[model samples]
Target: MQIQLNTDNNITGSPELLSRIQKVIDHELRHHAASITRVEAHINDTNSAKKGEQDKRCMLEARIAGMKPLSVEHRADTVSLAVSGAASQLARLVDTTLGKANGSEKGGVSIRHLSQNEQEE
Candidate 1:
């Protein structure tokens, strides 16, 4: 899978930072490597460097094969926290979405809807 990193004016996109983010994504999406095509991450400061505000924003988008891209976003005081939160959410989303695409039952329960005629009978 491929990964792209983007940073707004407030945050700097360093090589180390990119490596760290990519590592987190790879670790979280280990099982879905085959189905996931690419992931793009964006980090920005929502408050524009205002002092006491929790404005760090992280956005993640995962492209799944034959499926629309799934996205998640998180905000925190630190870029790391926001990125971590978004990464976890994106991983869960991929699992749920791909699981559904594979026809896997959800929550270990299956429900069937009966027709009106069958119910009457």
Candidate 2:
């Protein structure tokens, strides 16, 4: 994916150059994938969610770099991240509201305590 174009932006007679670049890209991909898998496994075994997130970030960055033409390869990751983030935020909002309602109900208290206390006179 390394654009090996000269100043003229032409790939003319660059077959060998492209082959060499492909080999480098292949090696990087293997290295990145191995590291990513190890990190993922370690993260799965961890109880600390924060640490798991950090590990994920590190692994993703390595994976991105290992991708040839990183700028283009990362588009999928970016879109997925945005979608997941939005969904998570929405879920948190719903959970917070439901939890508060549940807690208030369990407290046995309401806004009309006076009538229930028989002091309406």
Candidate 3:
């Protein structure tokens, strides 16, 4: 999937940082890569120059084929932590959203179908 990184004025979008973020996202969402068309990561420091707990914020938006885009955000003390957290959240969200859309859970029978079978039985 295509990955893009964005940073606010306070934060520098360095090559190393971008690469690290990309790796984290790729690793987290590898299983859903085919369904994902693109991912955009927006990171910024909420406190700017000041130091604070959970000052760094990362927002990840993923575009899935034939579905509306999914987004998740996280905050942490460090950029890496924020990115990782956001990526993890996005992964779970994508799994659930896609699973429902496909009318199956982890490649198994659909819950709705199961309920219908039970009623008939």
Candidate 4:
């Protein structure tokens, strides 16, 4: 999947930072890479130069082929932590979305199979 990184004026989009963010996102979404077309990451310091807790904000948007895009965001004390949290959240959302699209049974029941069960009952 292609990854695009964006940062606000308060933050610098350095090569090292971009590489690290890419690796984190790649590792988290490896399972759904084939379905994902691109991922855009937006990072910023909410407090700018001021010191504050959980000021680093990271937002990740994943575009999947033939499906609506999904987005998730996280805030933490550090940029890495924020990105990690957002990636994890996005991974879970993608897994749930793909599972539903494939009609995978979730919680031991599938909505598509519910009608059959009702008729039998």
Candidate 5:
């Protein structure tokens, strides 16, 4: 994945940045894989369990694998989605913080108690 940083704003990109991103992606992938593995293993472990869920899971896995599934693509997509969500959350936090700071300076809300509020438009 071509990760771009705003180099003009002193946001220089480096190999270390790429490595860190890779690591984060890897960790997220591991979590996803672990969950799927756990589910499949649980189904297998419970020999006398309901066959419906197991069959569904197996079918799901089969369909996914049939789509030329590589664990890497799944991992990358998962990581990208997670990072996007986190960035969105962080942006909201920053906007709220700045807004509250401005408000407090004008004798509105108290800066000391600026916990997460409702999402602003």
Candidate 6:
């Protein structure tokens, strides 16, 4: 899957951060990589230097073939935490989406017809 990262000014949005986020997403969702076309992650600081905690927000959108886009959001005290939390959510979302699209429920058996020779055995 191709991962695209975005962040507001309040967040550092460094290349290292983006790389780390991408790696997390890739590792978490590796099984669904083929079906997924792209992933867009938006990170921001809701409080923007405010004194209160849990201000960072992370929104992730994953696009899969023959299915509606799947999204997940998480809030944390820092951008890294938000990213990690969101990535985990996105992983589960992709897993369920792929399962449904494959006409299976969480890796359930897919019944199929067998050829005449094979069926005889």
Order by lDDT, highest first: 4, 3, 1, 6, 5, 2
Best by lDDT: 4
Q: Between which residue pairs do clashes occur in model 1?
A: none
Pairs of colliding residues, candidate 5: none
Query: Which pairs clash (backbone N, Cα, C closer than 3 Å) in model 3?
Result: none
Q: For each candidate in turn, give its C-alpha RMSD to the true structure in angstroms.
A: 4.8, 19.9, 3.1, 3.6, 19.3, 4.1
**Backbone clashes in each candidate structure, one number apiece?**
0, 0, 0, 0, 0, 0
lDDT of 5 by residue, 80-112 (tens): 343433333333343344445467543356545
lDDT of 4: 0.94
Q: Estimate each model's TM-score.
A: 0.84, 0.22, 0.88, 0.87, 0.26, 0.84
What TM-score would you give candidate 5 relative to the actual structure? 0.26
Cα error of candidate 6 at position 113, Å: 14
TM-score of 6: 0.84
Candidate 4, residues 11-113, lDDT tens digits: the string is 9999999999999999999999999999999999999999999999999999999988899999999999999999999999998888888867341345454
- lDDT by residue (1-121, candidate 3, tens digit) is 9999999998999999989998999999999999999999999999989999999999999999888899999999999999999999999999988878877666456546456769577
Higher-TM-score candidate among 5 and 6? 6
Return the clash pairs for model 4, or none: none
Arranged by TM-score, best first: 3, 4, 1, 6, 5, 2
Better of 1 and 2 by lDDT: 1
Q: Measured by TM-score, how close is model 4 to the native structure?
A: 0.87
* TM-score, cand. 3 vs. native: 0.88
